[model samples]
Target: MSSLFGILSAAGQSLLTFQRGINSTNKNIANVSTEGYNREIPVFQDLPRSGVFMNKIIRVFDQSLFSRSIDLNQKLNSDNEFASGLSNIETIFNDALGTGFSSDLNTFFNSINDMLIKPDDLAARSQFLANAQTLVGKIRNTDKALEDLKQQTVLKVRDQINQINQITSQLAKLNQSIKTKTLDIEVNNEYLNERDRLIKQLSDLIDTKVVFNEDNTVNVFTAKGYGLVVGIESTQLSFETDSNGNAVVKWNNVADITKEIQNGQVGGNLKTIDKVNEQLNKLNDFVTVLTTVFNKVHRQGYGLDGSTNTDFFTIDPSKSGTKIDASNVYINITDPKKVALASDPKYLNSDNTNGKNLLGLKNNISNLYTNPSQPVLTPTEEANLKASLNDPTNYDFIKTHTFAEFYNTKLVAEVSSTSSYIKQQQQNNKYLYDAITEKMKSITGVNMDEELINLTKLQRSYEASARIITVTDELMQTILGLIK
Candidate 1:
């Protein structure tokens, strides 16, 4: 009778075990399509029976394997995030290649070269001025585009921070739930699934390290050592513009978090914006120098037909901001008919038959277009030029001899090199992104066929266990009838 009772108890335990197995199978099937869901299994163990017989059934997760899986999933998410960021950065600069400011600048310089062949022609000069205006317009447009990109980057950072906060909050709530709930294997499995999903989400925002605490809670931190989530609370992040108009990102209103937020979308976007700003600054300086030098040369020359008091160009000194405004300057030679040596009184006694000064002025203007010297006026030179223009002491020499050729060459070369470097960086980013994305897909992406197979197998195991329980019940009924 005791042996029979032991058999009955073993059968009863098997029936319960079968029911839990069926539930686990159903759960796996239901969540098969869910993103970030890991397939779960019920682990079984035999209880030591009295007098050399096994009694109860024990089912739990393989904790070592589950923990390792979680770690791998987090790594996969981080790599995917970094790849996505790099891809976006590549797209921005790749599109910048054909229809960008660099192309526009090349066209504008070519137009200037075209105008130089006919320096005396008023229509040609007008075309040159128009191209110059267009060039400045392109610079302004490009600078604005860069500023827009910077603003977009700031917004992206804010969005990511918001997402991080939401995930962390969810994690904190899960921590509380897990601690309060009873540790039935079935219930713990559900909590673990939710925890894994939140962890993956957090991983995508930034690379992180996960710590499993004693009470089944997770502690998350950046790879660079900034806390994300701890027990029942999360550190909050915020972004704002500083007094200097630079974007600042902070955490907990105490710690500086920017450096720790590395290699993600926010970091990639910030890097791109910084590069654009640097390029814009270089271009602005180029334009400012061009305008300054051209005005210096134009102010010294007498008007066509040589009027001593007349100026060929008028430029506003205040237009020398970080941005170039072409409206501040005007080339006043409108009439082609008035462009001869005798148009002004200064040319009346000025070697009209030889036309030396007039020829020199035309040559100097042509040289400006062709040679393009840098505006290298030192403080002393600028002061002398200003004094000479104000008081008229050898105005011709100051105008022609004051320009520096080497300085202009160096500036042009620098701008050209910078543009090239930016292009190269964009290309390299594309290659790196593609490679990393392919690697992540291999590891983290779902295999539908494998999941279907597992589902069918678990379903069969559950049904077999149910059949065993039904057989045991029938056997017990027969025994009771015999006893009666």
Candidate 2:
């Protein structure tokens, strides 16, 4: 179907095609260990009555695998943030760290029990006051710590939002470049690689959806259907603070869509802020109820100074309300002699009846320590308190237990349970995320062995094509000698 010159030209074309294939294999081998690198596949097309033609080189890509990987990565990041936040909260209440509120509470209550035995001893009374002061200081410090954590979460969220904006902008720019190259019928493997990498990065900061276009541009969106990028244009996300100082993710500063952002570091930071605030609220409530009940009983007793109605602990005057918060709790009475120890004693100096009565009040104080909202009660205390209330005759003052039973049973137990649940969730997420990530790598990742095999094949083809060119030249030389 062709002449000798045509045959020679065809052989030369075959040589070039094979060389290009070898070059592509070499590139693949070079980047085999590169992170996020995809294997380049060289395409070949048969020429019309010729040998072969080299087509464009494209990287091996699985769009579906890539999209799924993005989703899993976002969730993995969110779970990590959540687990770290829960650990921080656990540290706040960890008794092993020597900073737990439970320790201070136990010490203060033990000091009070000792005071009940030596109500007239001034030294015991002073120790009781000192322990109470220490307890208050611990509560205040804990509250401050939680506040600081909340602020940190807020700042992290703001930083994440900024990063997200930056990522989306870059994606938009890459989208435009890719579209232009594709429209011009140019090879765009580099642009495609960059775009895929950018999309994955965007998904890590925030959950994203990508829709590919015919022009090689992709439209990116938030999981909530907010457009991140459409063709060449992109929108930026921002955060607006609510009156409570909570950071709310906003779409163009128009709507409050904080709840829509889930499964990313941004979402996790917001959720962490909420978790920290929840624990802070519970601690404040405990402080309020403790101060209220203690002061209530102290009010019923007479001090050594014969003060009939003295408030041992006071709420801040500006913040005084029906309930006392930890931030506002203060020791109202300063004089150690002002410590109440008599309920209806004949002499304030010699009366241990009030101290004994205060101990008796511990049984009734179950109602104060047990948060009706949370309803976290020790089963025994709940049943006993119910029974005592129903039949006051069965109430035993000698068997009363207050602070120790309630504090451990309610707050400490709750923190432990929450921490355990968060840790389990993190482990499960990590396992799932790792499995998916490995799957994606297997699909798109370069294989050195496979590349070597391809390289050998290309080398053989190149040698064959070179031999054909040499044979054609030798035959032409022989024909020319015969003609001469």
Residue lDDT tens for model 1, 1-484: 5555665566566556656655665666676566655555556566544111222223223445444444444444433443443344333333246323344445544553443354355575456556655655555555555566567766776787788889888998898888786646567656876887787667656557788887778888776767778888788777777663446678787777665555445555555445545544443444444444444444434444444434334444555433232234433445432332232344443323212332332224223332246333556665654453322322333355421221223223444454455456545655555455444433433355654675576467556645655776677778888999
Candidate RMSDs in Å, in order, are 8.3, 6.3
User: Deviation in angstroms for 105 in model 1?
Assistant: 4.3
Expressed as tens digits, the lDDT of each residue in 250-308 for candidate 2 is 88777677888877888777778888867766666566545655676677678887787
Once fitted onto the true fold, the runs of candidate 2 whose alpha carbons sit more than 4 angstroms away are 182-187, 316-323, 360-363, 366-406, 474-484
lDDT of each: 0.52, 0.75
Clashes of 2: 0
Best-matching candidate per TM-score:
2
**Where does candidate 1 have its weakest 10-residue lDDT segment?**
50-59
- Candidate 1 TM-score over all chains jointly: 0.66
Model 1 misplacement above 4 A: 1-6, 48-98, 101-120, 305-376, 379-484
